[model samples]
Target: MIDAGALTRCRHRVHLDAAFPEQLAAAPEDPGVRQRQDAATAKREGIRRTLTEHAPDRWVQIDREQSARRRAEDTLAACAAGADRIWGAVLPLDRDVGRKAHCEILIRDTDRGGYIPVIVVNHKVTDPGRGAVTSGMFEWEPREDLARKPRGQARDQMRVAQVYRMLEQHGFASPALVAGAIGYGSDVIFVHDLTAILEDYDERFVDRLAIARGESATVPSKIGECRSCPWWPGCEEQLTQTHDVSLVASGSRADLLREAGCRTIDDLAAWDQEPIEDWPHGAFEDAVVTAKAWLAGAPLVRRYSQIRVTRADIEVDVDMESYQEHGAYLWGTLLNADGISVYRPFVSWDPLPTPDEARSFAEFWTWLMAEREAAALSGKTFAAYCYSRAAEDKWLLDSARRFVGTPGIPTEDEIREFIDSPQWVDIYQAVSDQFICPAGKGLKKIAPVAGFRWRDADASGEASMSWYREAVGYDGEPDLSQRERLLQYNEDDVIATKVLREWMSDRAESEIPLATDL
Candidate 1:
């Protein structure tokens, strides 16, 4: 299904890669040293020979000396009919097109500026023999045409129409928010990241959408969940009268008791003995007491903490790195209720693997946890975003579980309330959204936009970081100096997060309409 979206994403990858003069230019400094000189030479030479030999009469502009010209030519022949060629376009592709078939051609048109195009996409390093164009290109569509299609419909024609309709409906601002909200849902995040990747290369994706339609009814409804999810509150949803209560742990007791033929607490209390699953003892006394007191054969009201932390206990805004170094840092600003910072951003590093290294990292966590308890200094606890360098940090969870109590917390409501209230042990759930950004959610993309920027020269933003870790040097162990550098690198992320979160909250309140009527 060759469509605009697919092309756009490929185009985006190509365009983003354009910044790397180190990869494309022939001696970026010298101008003659295209990154892959040998590959370019071989490919150009092959093209020159093939074109010259195949159709002797065909005109050949032998600009082997000029890298841009060579690339331009390669791009031309790569397109259909090799007549109407394009340049400035191939720059947006996912493949780090090797010298093999990485050249492009340009053509001047009277109406538009110039058509930049895809070249020999089939020559991609990862997937062999599949040219960009031949491999299913996206189609162009009108906004009205697209709006009629349903989501999850992946047909090529339908996609073109759907994309146009979506673009017409959301435009940049709402789409961006939509993209963010989508990232909150795993399924939606996939779509957002995919669209971002595709939008870059495909010209069809860059079309101007109708702004009126962009502000469609669908925007608010879809975005509501992301904006209001209880998890980010350090507690996603509390038991509302209907949906909330049914969704809680205590609700499970209702089910259990009912199954045991003990619908009411009177039945439960008067039974000869409580069954194993009857919520035996101390399960839900308050609600039971309240219900028994009513004596109207009435139902009991179960309560669950629906707390949200406008503030935090240990506000550690985190970014994770899994390559050579498992790097992390903390921007823990323990503040008083009066907004005075007790402890500012604190950096920490961990190169330890295997949970057994608890001995080695105890000091690291102690310091981290100590910052959380900073409220002790002022008797004012805060909230935090609890995330880790690794996804499966069971030990981190276990540690929280182990130490969360010992303060005489007797009931699940108390535990839930304590965890959800302004005094949150961790704040990771709040920061890790359901969406995926093309550059990712790290400070590189997040920092500068929030009126702050990343510090440290070695700190390659998300793109470079991805290249550094995922592409090469992904060994479990990174350089010692690099490890420390990464930890410090993370500190800025936490700071960035704090800054960004507050900034965005303010902006949304001031700038956005915030009606959410869909």
Candidate 2:
């Protein structure tokens, strides 16, 4: 059956899953997905408990342990009995349309004389400002008394729409085109106006349905989602053998290049003509450079004659580790000054989403500021480096805001000032500006080229996420060894950034070939 998730998944994946199930390769185990599923289950249970506490006698819960058919039967019986709420309701599969849905909660709308779907998801659904209204924790109907903040979760909306369509088919949908979702770590029910989203949802569902029915082409293109896709190995093999343009260029760039008769890396490398329509000047040139570099098996090539890298007398490489959306639990810093280097880790052993997070973040911020002050006083220039400023800056501002009253936490303005200053160096941006990396520009991709390696062979942000869960005892008893492994992994990350910066400054110009030379 075409479940809600399938509607938003890779279209090629939907086709393969439906039409070529035997050809589907197994994707690597992603512990993060399991972690999120467990967390979502906990949140769903929490929401149900809260609802039960308020209106214990009004709710009917469908047993998830029961068979799907039995659960669907129970759900319809609950509706027939005019139950106020049905938790974990599995709708009967619609064979005609090949659609099925497992709703988190279905609340009976008394005024509309039918049920409305409520989806519980593992991410925030609101932006913390009033733009929408929601139901009371005890009530199902949207409350006029409350003005709640709301944000769009497209996936959640589409899921809700699918359930709504199922309800409509069975004559159980609420007349009002509305639904609600409970987001991660939130009590407020975020409501959605499904009417506005249904048209778009229907269009996507139709397209996916066509693909699943084997009525549409299922050409696989390398994309961000392919990293976790089960068909990746097969698709990568096909793309490599076919010399697909998408191997070197991505998204619209690949489409544009193909339209310009550059269908493969070889084609792109040879075509030195005018820029493709809608391409920014020099972007196509860079794409061609990427093609040539890819064909040459070069991980990276210089974009210009000289590579400029920022350095300081007192330089600090920083990396922060966070547990999902809980909090930044560890701030790993490598301080270098006067020919001496030391690694310092400000970490909270406490489980994330705890008050101790403030302590760890505050300590790191205080130490960093102290070092900056000391450097300035000694007439030494100072700079703090991170691979990418986006991830680090997000948490920096978020931490400052979340733990505002906590000791040692910087003000939002202070954090902003530091990030905006020249003293804050984003090494990733520097690499991107001076080089064209056909492989990628992530620290893990570029660091090895500079001869920097992680202590843990399997060191990766994804693997680190699983490590953090074990270190903090998310699954069961905490494994303290995982904590050390995580520290070493994080330490290696900060050092990788340091080594990358040094290599760009010292060796890149001579070792790397300029794009013009290619």
Candidate 3:
């Protein structure tokens, strides 16, 4: 039988070749199929490849990706014709005579004839980021059905809800199942040693199996009006009944109010909550004030500004640093800035926007976070993306142990308990992704690419992990000075990231404006 190590090596090579044809120039099958499957994996495909953490729900729901993997397997199977049963994650589920499930692999020592591992990392797999909302593809779906319910929770109860049907189609968010497949397939195949598995199997092989899986859910937001959002019709209907905000002239109100110079909602509601905000000379507020507006049943006063982006004259940029928790190193960089760089990730950077988003000592940290409440309706931000993930490891045990001076919980353990809570963002990922990472597209390699030059210092390209490993055994005082050094290193990380972004922007402006459109 083929050893698990060889199987891992073979499968990962297949994933990298199949997923990123352009980057590798290594076709899915030697060279014959280069026409389509191996065509330059476009920016879109590259971005799709970057989404390794995201995966399909089941073994069969995703076909196109399966077909690609199948083609890749055909060639590899040809070379490995010399070996016995091909070890795989998912077992060989019964299939119609010609249909393919997962390639059958043998486990030497399981009760159920050594059950195989199955992983489903299809690019087509969609998730309703941890905020508990479904994708916005259908119109009639309710808010609870689309935004709050898990597909797994409602799947078996399909007729009970629309979201249920989706879950029925996708399946549950599972780690063991996911880890089994990705351990040997696409997730980290190109980045790591999926190909480095052992030749023979033994009980020790279980511990040797290094697999990780988690709910790497992205946030839900509208690419457009609810037309694509599952909760569209429901939210829209609800918005119409309670307040006729249409007269406000915009989705976010400050702009329209600015034109009329009315300034506050009390003035608008006083004018019967009409379009009087558009009235000249603040004439809009005059009408509402004229009608004993206080008692005219206008509306509750809006206590804050409708639009939140403050106009700053200084040149500000965004930078993202990506690193694993507990590890003392830098993983990658994602840099971003206004006016100069394109907002999209994959579309802009060849690898896209990981480190480009991390700018200058992470000064944008304050403003970026400050704008959260108002920026909710805007494009995906660092906060929304980082926080909504599942806690699948003990890596953050130290951070959980640290006392953050916040009001929410009483103890570090409590904060750790809620670390994966959908409402909170992972500060580690957020801080690293925003201020340090250059191309978060690949955490392992981006740090070196950005020139933080950390291989010798941290050794593994992660940050503070050594501290974490050490802390696990004893409660020594934190090496504050080393922490200070690490902080400076992290700050340097953001600075290096910002410099790299400027270089990319300049390069894009001259050589690849189209690429920069990302």
Candidate 4:
């Protein structure tokens, strides 16, 4: 039986196939994947230990070093013996029952005297504002005591539902499912009722589990989950053989066509000829055009008559470098005005936020505004061009807020206006609205299609992040070469944006229809 965690997270049949006994015995362990798994295990253990400390007499700890089957047996024994709190319990449903479910924790309710299944997650449940908690990709509103909420409120409700059913099978009576999220200084627990939802999904769950058990062929539902899945390489080959529409389109669009009996790219391309009733306007046609371009092995770029921006006399291509662990450290700008091109960089070498970083951010902001003023005086419009402007724009605004009251820092209103104005050109959006990229729509993916190449062969945002981390010298002396490499990578990114902008502007003269026009 697969665990509740697996049932919740694994979206593809290939994921289940990889988990089969044969595949597990043959597949090599990835060090990065193992490291992440180990980290999660440690976090869960840490939380369990903390909970035990809080109520030593109530909690009973289960040793996890035992084999999977033995652990499940031990958990059942503990529950049968009426343990008050079963920590790290593993309850697996009967395999002969056709559907398999395994739940982690089974805590006894002090007042009700019944066990409530708990799912532990090693993620922060931050209260951004109000009484809402950040649960996965969405914010959920919970009760005052955080005891219960609507089951459909969160994206990861499958985990709760699976756990609820598993507990019910084991004869544990409970009104709600509990989720324990590790917080900064304490653990925040949220409860939700899933009785009705589980009742509705019982039959569908059995059918899906049957497919996972290899009773039927599994269809690939391509989604964001494919990115980290180890089975993607094999599944991608299968998708290519079948010419699945998901190979080119993703999310709801792919699901919509598949549900409408248009399974493959060819099927989707021919959908327009016999349109589905109440089809979304222009969506089918757009998918068809995109699919045709993918089959032809050509870049699909469309041109719109309503241009977002024209060639400006003064333009600055901007890119920012930041460590996920640390804050923004570098701001690279390629200034081009009236045939002259110059590179300017604002950098902070510190691993942590210091006065130096604050000064660098202030200087970058001051220089940019000065240039904008100069362009205004010269009767020329000034604009900042960036690929995937969200990250760069966020860092700029966040840095300004962090350095508020510091010298050379722009006011909140000034930064807000600049971000809201058309002066900030998001080249990514400009291209995405006009083009359909089957390869990818990322800066690195699309820039090369426009004949823009970085001087450094290994130049990438990920590589730059690694270089920045190494340059900071956590355990050894700082590597200047790494720092230099990161700077060059940032410079290349800005230059690529500039090149892409020019490429798009040149293509604007063509009589190609826009993606939306399709």
lDDT agreement of model 4 with the native = 0.68
Clashes of 1: 71
lDDT of 1: 0.34
Tell me each candidate's TM-score. Answer: 0.30, 0.94, 0.24, 0.75
lDDT of 4 by residue, 1-518 (tens): 45444444445653466347687567766544554454456557766767677678876677778876788888778777788877776666567654454444566655655576656654434443444332321112334543323223333456556665666677775544444333332335554455445654565566556656766566676777776666678878989998988887776677778787888988876565565545453455556777777676656546456545445779998888875524688989999987888889999887754668888888888898899889999999889888888888778787878888998888778888998888888898887777766677899888887788988996766456557656977436889989888888888898898887877777543634455444
Full-model lDDT for every candidate: 0.34, 0.86, 0.29, 0.68
Per-residue lDDT tens digits of candidate 2, residues 1-518? 69889877888889888986665544455665666677788777877788777777888989889999999999989988889988999999888897889898888988978888988887888765566777666676576423446676778988999999998988899999998888876566778888898999899988998888888987888777777777788889999998898988876677777777788889998887887867842477788888999888888999788888888999999999987788899999999998887999999989978999999999999999999999999999999999988888999999999999887989999999999999999999999888988988889999999999887888888778878888989779999999999999989999999899999999989988988878
lDDT tens digits by residue: candidate 3, 206-228: 22222111112211221223232
Query: In terms of TM-score, which candidate is stronger, 3 or 4?
Result: 4
Predicted model with the maximum lDDT: 2
- Candidate 4 Cα errors over 4 Å, as ranges: 8-108, 115-142, 145-155, 167-174, 182-187, 196-204, 271-282, 305-310, 321-330, 337-363, 377-380, 397-411, 454-488, 507-518
Name the regions of candidate 3 deviating beyond 4 angstroms. Answer: 1-464, 471-477, 480-482, 507-518
lDDT of 3 at 146: 31
lDDT of residue 127 for candidate 4: 41
Local lDDT at 388 for model 3: 17
Better of 2 and 3 by TM-score: 2
